[model samples]
Target chain A: MPKAPAGTLYRGREGMWSWVAHRITGVLVFFFLFAHVLDTALIRVSPTSYDKVIGTYKNPIVNVMEVGLVAAVVYHALNGIRIMLIDFWEKGPRYQKQMLYVELALFVILVVPDAYFSLEHTVRTIFGST
Target chain B: MTATVDGAGRPVIEAPRSRAPRPGRARARSNFELYAWVFMRVSGLALIVLVFGHLFIMNVLDGGVQRINWGFVAGRYASPFWRLWDLTMLLLAELHGTNGLRTVINDYAERPQSRFWLKMMLYTSAFLVVTLGTLVIFTFDPNISG
Candidate 1:
């Protein structure tokens, strides 16, 4: 008989979710870094080109995506510290679930305010025109 | 080992289940993985401060993104302190994120060919971005007007 379909590893536990989120956020941050570098480099070609590229970022779509970027950075940073603890601290693996909870709680506290600030800016930028 | 012939006439050695090695400690290799792990932690800690400060200055302070123009970038790049700061952030973030994805690809891609190709692509892109970014940081000139 064929083996059963592979179950999702992320469904296992808090640790699994943390692992999944770390990878997801890592990719997100990587892509952002790529674009950021490319756009910032436009300054070498010409200031007009640089301004034009960055000017596009003021649009509502890019504004929303900025929030996603912030979320990814926040989660990755938190989980990165957790991973370090797990690697170095003898008791870290044992209390990983508790650590994950703390990470999540902190994620919420940090992200909510950041989201508010980002959305507030975006809204103000989009609708604040005379 | 029991030998069997398939329809394709290929011999297969069927080792008994009892011979399977149980998962336990990983065999030691070079200290590369250890160093990579430590780099991720150290770079990540530094990135938290560098990245957030960058975001705050660019997007929150003063007039925010609206204030970012050619002149602003030119002025910032003129300062050696900001130049060094940005260069460090660029290198640390690129290396840390690249290593993180390397771990992800290793875990998810079971096929050897897939793993090799994916890593090749990842590394190439990482290299290109780092090179281009570094060049931009050091070579940027404010006097080059359109």
Candidate 2:
């Protein structure tokens, strides 16, 4: 058997990178939903359980994690659209790389403001100012 | 999308190689890919609305997370409106993400055994979550015994 190359994951063109990112983000979002549904289901047990669970999410660490979730979600959604276009549009496959660039651009644009707001909220909540 | 053998007896130019399933796997109907492809697009568009609306309602509007409590949840689910909304979002998002992961696994997993097991685990967990979530949404009882 041939030995695998080092940095194999990093060695990819734009489309490959986007494919990797989409898969990673997709997995992250899936796990997030898993946790989210479990937590939300706490409501069925009792409101107290639900509120207490949600209360745990107000800390600094969890708040930062939320920002990361936001980033993952933003990228996944944008790249998902890119994938859709590539599959559906007649001209899409030919310009897959260009579409990836556009997706990345939009990802940065949306995630930056979202991260900012998420952090701002985190700070306020941590300080008990809000 | 035909393959031809070279002078050395190696098959050449398997043009449909990318779309073909791994060896030993049953070939899917050609339209399956097309349907899965279309499902992603349609479900994705639906999720944008359902998910964003959920985020906005839960985290941004009317005093955000602080305002979230049993009462808040009960109030929302008290109406059929929020129940349907949450239910739709839950089902669509789960199915869409699961299908996307299925494609990822099919594309990347080198071993057929690995692919089969991975998808088995995925479908099992997805079923558990979706079922539990749906039941919770529909059968939630606001009153609890002390």
Highest lDDT scorer: 1
| Reference-based lDDT, residue B40, model 2 | 80
What would the TM-scores of all predictions be?
0.82, 0.78
Model 2, TM vs. native: 0.78
The fraction of correct interface contacts reproduced by each prediction comes to 0.68, 0.52
Candidate 1 residue lDDT tens string, B1-146: 44587679998876667745556635645899989977888898999999988877876567566578889988888899999999999999999889988988887787889999999999999999999999998888777979
* Model 2: residue A75 alpha-carbon error in angstroms: 1.0
Regions of candidate 1 where Cα sits further than 4 Å from its true position: A1-11, A125-130, B1-28
lDDT of 1 by residue, A36-128 (tens): 999988989998898899987776788777777888888888888898889889999998899999998998998777666656767776688
- lDDT tens per residue, model 2, B1-146: 44488788898875553665676657654787778777888999899888867766665566455567788888888899999999999999999989988988886787878989999999998999999999999998878532
Q: Give the clash count for each candidate.
A: 0, 0
